[model samples]
Target: MTWRFALVIQPAGVDDDRRDFSATFRTIDPAEPALSVGELSTQRGDGIFESIGVVDGHPQEVAAHLDRLAHSAEICDLPAPNLEQWRQAVARAAEHGERRGEGVIKLILSRGVEHGPAPTAWVTASAAADFTVPRTQGIRVVTLDRGYASDVPDRAPWLLLGAKTLSYAVNMAAIREAKARGADDAIFVTSDGYVLEAPTASLILKFGDRFTTPAPTGGILRGTTQQSLFDHLREEGYETAEELIPVDLLARADAAWLVSSVRLAAPVTAIDDTRIELDSGLTQAFNRYLLTPRD
Candidate 1:
């Protein structure tokens, strides 16, 4: 397969077969050009976005992912994106990538690329590389001292805690530091000592006879897989609960796992130098169910 070129073109409404380059003109020179004035000033106006994984031609829990995007948009004070329209855009982006057998989809909506402080909106979808295997090996993670930074506590600045947003500089920095320190991922805990979350996913623990994860109110992003696991566990005679787990609790738990759209459910085999002495019996039980999802 010889690679040719990647072109970013055809907004949602464009005629795909017409090959009309005239209507779909480029503003900033793809090679080098200055961003428009509005882009510079209105970058933070208001927007909603989403990222979903297309595996074996399947968009894993796409509906759940969009619900989260809409929830995050509302939290960010952004205009609600048309749900069905966005869905189609993701499908198109996934299809555009020939490797639809397995890949990632990124959907972004920001203030319209036009000028002024207007509440305009735009959407862009693109293919992404797949990196789902490493997450299964159980990523090495580090804990951060700062409980996620927030502007106003009353607004529950941590509301964005779980919402996946483009504003992820801090999370990236944390991951960078972790990699610098030869670790795989990072975790942050609230000052009160409750385990907050991983840089990009929700945290959970597998204790005796139970599957425990933090509740949304715990300032953690609502995890779709974790929710599925709850349903999965309940049917298998296992109990699930959301508790304010002490950040340090992970270090003491029987076993720890990071749950998200990509990883699904990955065990934290270790925390720092602390070897997670897991009670595999429970994991074996869950694995049986996971291997053949009821869905």
Candidate 2:
């Protein structure tokens, strides 16, 4: 049977501008069976989405995120959201969520919502989830040898792996595999041993006196936090490079860190059981730069 669902709106208040925006859903009946965000498998999965952290009621790098979302929707052939309408809707949900002071906001757009066995465009918002910085102990991660499914052809041929899309099953599965090995996350690596990125975030590391991250060309998302750090550090005379990174070599580096919107900056003390120097001049500078409040 076809299912219905409700769009849950989280209002913005407390510190936001108090503007309101509404998102959507099908209003599925609670009596019916349910699948999870990571469990849908029957339909052609074609959609786009992004998650941004709300800091003191503001979404960090808000303009860049909106631009990326719109670009991703275009690449996936999803209907363009009326930017004006979308802005207002997100504003409303944030206001209703009352998580404006400190929280995370997820903006999702699906072209797989069906009315009667056929999918249609639908946009929705989840209630604001809690946001907190992760610990400094750092996360352990595994490297994935293959991307997506081993056999199925890539649907979004234009899929910019860097764009935040809702098609995250592969990423989730990679994390599971990493965890089975006692790691906290997963990293995607090319067959030749070049580092692509971690499952959900961008990877960055220090090699001697320089800081580097995988190029977006290698399927790594150009992260806002990474971008912020690059710019902030460059002003301080740190050289940043965007190029192919050999996985084996990063293990021999002075230090490494994976960056994200909410997790902020997490340093890596070990990789595949190999220990790394966790404290250094570069990492200390990064810590000082990252601790500043978001611009």
Candidate 3:
């Protein structure tokens, strides 16, 4: 990805005076090195992040992304991010880009350097990858065991399963494992046999006129894109829901998709070796709505 803009943020406490809020952001060269070697984000992946899709220079779903960022911070015991400060930062970062076509804005808040006095924060804007083929032609996925039960989130809070932390090594490994097995992506399933989510995206399955995603309760990051699409689907007179999904149900679904911020909505053409019929009309409608600018 080619970064077009970068800004280092001086995060403010919730109670801090905001009269000089603009001063909290400093523009920087995206190609330059601006982080310390001992930063916890680099050393231990101790941080939280959010990727907001940008369409024609407008950052989509700012409020939802910010809310998730705060939720992740709370889960990780990191200091609460002043939403107002981050909000302005996102707008500023978006302005520096070419403001055309599709792009993305990523917000990051780290635990900072080991033994340091404060946290580290920044934002970067860059052009998004071309996902036309995946969005139009669809992708094939394989299921991998996540090595835990569906109730693991409630049973083990210390694992930080629901937070969108910087610790994505395992998720990346899962995708690589899928590719090695002749698949495009991987869907994580509980050891006890329940559907979870894709490594970096939320899984949505359609049965007749009803659509369902794995309930967000079990360590799955609440997908902002999926939530928005659900609203759109509901308005179009389709039923949408979040519920526990059994692994065997993948074969029974009429259609399915793996949705995320940058990739938008990608239809799942197959699971393991089982073929799924792609709903071309619905997929096009979904991307048409997503490509439009939304606050």
Clashes of each: 3, 21, 0
User: How many pairs of residues in model 2 come into backbone collision?
Assistant: 21
What tens-digit string does per-residue lDDT give for candidate 2 at 1-295?
A: 1211224323222244433343332333335454344422235455666666555455566665667777776666665654554565445434444433444556665554344332233323333333232334666666777544311223445755555667778888888998899888777887667888887777888887798898776255668778888888789888999887777877777877877766666777677878766664555566556545555
**Candidates by lDDT, descending order:** 3, 2, 1
Candidate 1's displacement at residue 180, Å, is 2.2
TM-score for each of the candidates: 0.74, 0.73, 0.98
Please give, for residues 155-193, the per-residue lDDT of candidate 3 as tens digits: 888799999999999999999999999999999999999
Segments of candidate 3 deviating more than 4 angstroms:
1-3, 17-20
Q: Which candidate leads in lDDT?
A: 3
**True-structure lDDT of candidate 3:** 0.93
Per-residue error (Å), model 1, residue 1: 9.4
Looking at model 3, residue 133 earns an lDDT score of 99
Question: lDDT for model 2, on a 0 to 1 scale?
Answer: 0.60
Winner by TM-score: 3
Q: Report lDDT (Cα) of residue 61, candidate 3.
A: 94
